[model samples]
Target chain A: DAMVIQNPRYQVTQFGKPVTLSCSQTLNHNVMYWYQQKSSQAPKLLFHYYDKDFNNEADTPDNFQSRRPNTSFCFLDIRSPGLGDAAMYLCATSSQTFGDTQYFGPGTRLTVL
Target chain B: GESVGLHLPTLSVQEGDNSIINCAYSNSASDYFIWYKQESGKGPQFIIDIRSNMDKRQGQRVTVLLNKTVKHLSLQIAATQPGDSAVYFCAETDSNYQLIWGAGTKLIIKP
Candidate 1:
């Protein structure tokens, strides 16, 4: 069973188009996070949801938004995909504790044309 | 902002040999540190973690050493295997849930 799953392992979209990436976790973790990683660089936090509370990173662009309908599902919405936004988007989950180790899903590779 | 960092960007070792990866963090208040391994096309997988109160922690084939004095952390893998070849990253978290990540080190296992 996949602990965390991301649909469409690879996604391609045109510039300025709207695209959505979905993530679901079977672990029922209270904390879910979205990260954007390009090439070999460190993954940057876009936003997260702790239960139903949404937290956005200060540096995250306004074009990126997130929604968590329930405990098990989360979605990343790119209102206007840009060439710079083409990268691997990773989804992770963790418990409520600050030190709890996060479990990750296979990332979705996004390509902008 | 202070962030987690690593000295080396890549490491190479032979199979059956030991591998060591080093990381440094400037945030003295960070109470938790974690190590993750990411293979090509996959997200990071948790390998091990250490709490600020502890200086060292070990897993089945891995050991984590934390030197609060120097604000350094390290991961040691015993008898490295081919499957161990991946990008390794260190993350530090304060009392908050937000985590600061270090640029990963690519581990190359020579078989």
Candidate 2:
């Protein structure tokens, strides 16, 4: 099945420590997105890449950054993980521009200690 | 009792019955709408979608209704089952092409 894949389904990091989550897609979608989701809340878009063009949400914190080294792989790097950053990180891909149906991964659950 | 804000609004339904989930979107200019289902410890999965131009769209056992006048959207599920228990969310595509998401509703299935 052509699907999105995320590494380290559960991650634990110390406060102020750096952590990286990875996502790769087999769907060959041009757009890849990263979202932060806290318990019982909606998935909030942190940033996305459209074939190397990075688009960051205005409200996204500076600590969070993303890099799409290639078409199939994208990484989310948190410069300093905070306690509040403990949440599920989801990766999704859309075939084209916005309004396209997104394919999502199982998500990486981060725990900041 | 836990504070109301601590949890998502929940709807409990009996298995084999029909289920309806509702959402009120904020953008009047939103031209596209999608419904997603998120199971526990998993990312959201696309269920169905309806465009502003159309009022209704249906999929396998699922239907989405969009009311542009009221800015309301709904998802209807038939023959609810244990597998249908999950958090359902509605999202709209704004003018910027960004998806503005709604607070999700949790569905519970009773035997």
Candidate 3:
């Protein structure tokens, strides 16, 4: 099946340490997005890439960065893991023409200790 | 400001019965709406979608109804089963690009 795949379903990191989560899609969509979801909240958009053009949200912190090396892959880099940053990080893909239906990956659960 | 909210935080439904989840969006200009089902430990799965020009749309076993006047949207799931237990979210976007998501409603299926 052509779907989104996330690496390291669960990750544990020390406070202030840096961690990275990755997402790849086989669907060959033109856009990719990264979201942060807390326990009982909606998914918050962090950043997105339209082909090679990156769009970062206004509220996104400097500690967070994203890299889309190619059409199939996107990476989320957390410069310093904070306790508040512990949450499920999700990656989604959508076509430029029909970007409403976003297909998401299983997600990576980050735990900061 | 764009905001999307759900009427109820949780919904309980009996097995074999139908379930209705409701949402209210503040952005009237939003053109497209989508419904997603998220199981525990997994990302959201796309369920159905409806455009602003349409009043309703249906999928395999799901229906999405949009009321533009009230800026409300609803999702109806038929033949609710155990596997239907999950968090349901409603999202909308004007350009069908960047989506503004609503606080999800947790659906619980009871036997």
Candidate 4:
């Protein structure tokens, strides 16, 4: 099945350390997005790549960054992990034609110690 | 910033009953709306979507209703099952195409 995949479903990192989460898709969608979901809260958009253009949300922290080297792969890098950064990181993809219907991966759970 | 929000934080329904989850949006310019279901320790899954031009759209056992006048959207599930228990969210997008998500509603099934 053509779907989104995330690596290291569970990640543990020390405080102030950098961590990277990866996402790959087989659906060949033109848009890839990264969202941070805290406990009992809605998923907040961190950044997204529409083709090669990167769009970051205004409220996203400086510690969060994303890169899409190609259509099939995207990575989220946290410059310095904090205890409050523990949350589920989700990767989603959608075609430009049907941008409303986004397909999401299983998500990576990050735990900052 | 304008965003989408749900009226209720949680709901408990008996198995086989119909469930209705409501959401309100502050962005009147939103042209697209979607409903998503997120299971524990998983990502949000697309359930259904309705464009602003349409008032209703249905898929499988789920139906989405949009009321442009009040900027309200709803998801209706028929014959609710234990498997349907999860966090449900409504999202809206304008011409910018950035989705604004709502605080999800926890749907609890009572067997």
Candidate 5:
């Protein structure tokens, strides 16, 4: 099936350490997104990539960064993971149109120690 | 910062009953609305969506209603099952392609 896939379903990192999560899509969507979700809260958009153009949310912290090396792959890099950064990181992909629905990966659960 | 929010935090329904989850959006320019379902330890799955031009859209066992006048969006699930227990969220995207998301509503199915 054409779907979004994330690596390391669960990750544990030490405080102030760097961590990277990866996402790949067989769906071949043009736009890919990264979202951070804390317990019982909304999945907040961190950043997204439209081809090679990266769009970061205004409120996203400087520690968070993303890279889309190609059409099928994207990566989220946290320069310094904090305890507050412990959350589920979701990767989603969608068509280029405004109203297109997004398909999601299973998500990576990050635990900062 | 703009936001999409839910009217309720939790909803409980019995099996075979129907469930309705409501959301409110801030941006009037948002033309696309989607409903998502998230089970424990998983990503948000797309349920249904409605365009601003339409008041309602239906899917397999779900219906999405959008009331532009009030900026209210709703997801209705028929024949609720234990498998349907999860968090439901609503998201809206403006013409700019930025999708504003709502705090989700947790749905509990009672057997």
Candidate 6:
């Protein structure tokens, strides 16, 4: 079974346009994370939600926003995407237990033109 | 400020041979470590993990070694296969539960 799911495996958006990527999980985890990964680079932490308490990374741009309406759903919203925003967006979920392992979705690849 | 990094960016290994990937982390406060495998166009999948109290853990065909003294971590694959060819990353987290990731090591399978 797919524990974590992201819609629209691939997305293309015009520059300065708004885009939203959705993530859903069946694991019923308490934590959800969003990461941005460029080619040949590590995944950068964008933000995460610990049961509706949104936590944004220090380097995360203001253009990026997230909403977790419930434990099973989380959304990543880019107010205005730029060409630099083109990358693989990954969604992960984890429980709060000690030594908790994070489960990741297939990921959504975003392309900006 | 603290981060995790791989010793090598890429490694090529022969099929059926043992493969080892190494990582270094700067934070001594990190108590938990995990190894993730990311195939092309796919999200990272959890391979194995170890806590600070233990130095070693093993899974199917995979083993993770942690050296807290040098703050080094390594992943060993018993029999490298084509399916094992992917980017491997090591991540660490402290009490805060924020995971810091390494750049990753691309394991190439040589025929």
- Can you give the lDDT of residue B37 in candidate 4? 97
**Candidate 6 has which clashing residue pairs, if any?**
none
lDDT of 6 by residue, A1-113 (tens): 99999988999999999999999999999999999988878888899888988888999999999999999999999999988888899999999732488899999999888
lDDT of 2: 0.92
Which TM-score does chain B of candidate 5 obtain? 0.90
Clashing pairs in model 2? none
The chain A TM-scores for the candidates, taken one by one, are: 0.97, 0.98, 0.96, 0.95, 0.97, 0.96
The TM-score leader among the candidates is 2
Give candidate 2 misplaced runs (Cα > 4 Å): B1-5
Each candidate's number of clashing pairs is 0, 0, 0, 0, 0, 0
Instruction: List clashing residue pairs in candidate 1.
Output: none
Best by lDDT: 2
Worst 10 residues of 1 chain B by lDDT: B1-10
DockQ of 1: 0.40
lDDT over C-alpha atoms for residue A5 of model 6: 100
Q: Write the per-residue lDDT of candidate 5 for residues B1-111, one digit (tens) a residue.
A: 112333548899999999999999989889989999999999999898888999999999899899999999999999999999999989999878777788889999999
For candidate 5 chain A, the 10 contiguous residues with the lowest summed lDDT are A94-103
Lowest summed lDDT across 10 adjacent residues in model 2 chain A is found at A95-104
Q: What is residue B21's positional error in candidate 1, in angstroms?
A: 0.5
Error of 4 at A61 (Å): 1.6
**What is the C-alpha lDDT profile of model 4 across A6-51, one tens digit per residue?**
9989999999999999999999899999999887788888988889
> In candidate 1, which residue ranges exceed 4 Å CA deviation?
B1-8
Candidate 1: residue A75 Cα off by (Å): 0.3
- Tens digit per residue, CA lDDT, model 5, A8-90: 99999999999999999998889999999878888888988888898888999999999889999999999998888898999
lDDT, residue A111, model 5: 89
Question: What TM-score, computed on C-alpha atoms, does each candidate reach?
Answer: 0.95, 0.96, 0.94, 0.93, 0.93, 0.94
lDDT by residue (B1-111, candidate 2, tens digit) is: 111234799999999999999999888999999999999999999999888899999999999988889989999999999999999999989998888898999999999
Interface RMSD of each: 6.9, 4.3, 6.8, 6.8, 6.4, 6.8
